[model samples]
Target: MQKITPSLWFNNNAEEAISFYTTIFKNSTVTGQAYYGENSPMPAGTLLTATFQLDGQEFIAINAGPQFPFTEAVSFTVYCENQQEVDHYWDKLLEGGGKESQCGWLKDKFGLSWQIVPTIMPKLLTDKDKQKAGRAMQAMMKMVKLDIATLEKAFNGN
Candidate 1:
């Protein structure tokens, strides 16, 4: 057991959300599920919690009802290798019911927000030349799901 596993609360789709997350990340899958028992908050057949692993990180989802919702204030950042990888995740995550926000941020179908960032973004934005870095940051601020190639082009003053 990990010392701490991030637990998420869902209205009623803990299982489905875990399945969807496992599919999106490599070496990931649902490990176990616990159904709501007698006297539990949810119905007997509904899920109380489900354990899942994504890229070696453990996560748990609980069908805790609609008291809380995911917000832009907190989101997971996926460091993508290239623009193709960024596009792939962006498209897949946005399908069905996701929405886009400015500056590489988006809310998936589950209302979970994520930041699909490029691996090389930090280096570009922290370049020795402050002006170049500033330009890159400015360009990134205008769009959602940052594109590596475009950011690079902006950094290069092109």
Candidate 2:
């Protein structure tokens, strides 16, 4: 068992969120779920919580009230191996009412913030050649969904 798992609080939509997430991530599964009972805040049989794994990372989601809403302060970063991976996640995560944000950040329909980052980002941003790194950084700042090709070109001073 994992030592710790990230827990998510949803506005009576934990099941929907779990379904959405499981479908989006290729390697994902719904491990367990619990439902509310009599005298509970929610109707009996309503989903109370769900435990799931995405790409081997365990997470538990609760069907809490609207008292808590997702904020950009906490975001999930999806490090992609290439531009294709980045584009795939970027498009899928923005499927419904997702909103785009600056510098590879976006908020999905569930209001959860996500960063679709390219794997090469760290190396480019920390290159020994400061000028190249700066150019790459500037190029990334101008993008909503990161483009690895553009970053690589900028890093190479092309």
Candidate 3:
């Protein structure tokens, strides 16, 4: 078990969100779950909490009613090795009611924020040559789904 697991609160679709995330990320599965009992505030059998793993990262989802909703203040970053990986995650994560945001950020159907970042992004954005780094940053800002080719071209002054 992870020392610190992130818990996401949902209105009442913790199960559905976990299922959707498992399908998008490989090697993911639901680990455990708990339902509200008859004496609880919610109806009996209502999902109270669910534990799941995504690519080895453990997360807890709770059906805590509608008191709280997901916000862009916090987001999960998906480090992709290349353009193919980036595209795959971007497409899969944006399915259903997901919406694209600037600079490789997006909100999934559950309103969870995700950053599909390319692995090369840091190297390109932090190059010693400020001009190259600036160009890469510019290219990235103009993109919704980050393109490694474009970033590389900008970095190379092409």
User: Considering TM-score, which of the candidate structures 2 and 3 is the better prediction for this target?
Assistant: 2
Ranking by TM-score: 2, 3, 1
- Residue-level lDDT of model 1, residues 30-105, one tens digit each, is 8888887788777788888888898889988988889998777768888899888899888878877999997888
Give a tens-digit lDDT track for model 2, residues 47-102. Answer: 99989999899999999889999999999999999888998999999998999998
Each prediction's TM-score against the native? 0.94, 0.98, 0.98
Best-to-worst lDDT order: 3, 2, 1
Best by TM-score: 2
Residue 124 in candidate 3, Cα distance off native in Å: 0.5
Each candidate's lDDT (Cα)? Answer: 0.86, 0.94, 0.94
- lDDT winner between candidates 1 and 3: 3
Off by over 4 Å in 2: none
C-alpha lDDT (0 to 100) for residue 121 of candidate 3 = 98
Instruction: Residues 102-155, candidate 3: write the lDDT tens digits.
Output: 899999999999999999999999999999999999999999899999899988
Model 1 weakest lDDT span, ten residues long: 69-78
- lDDT, model 1: 0.86
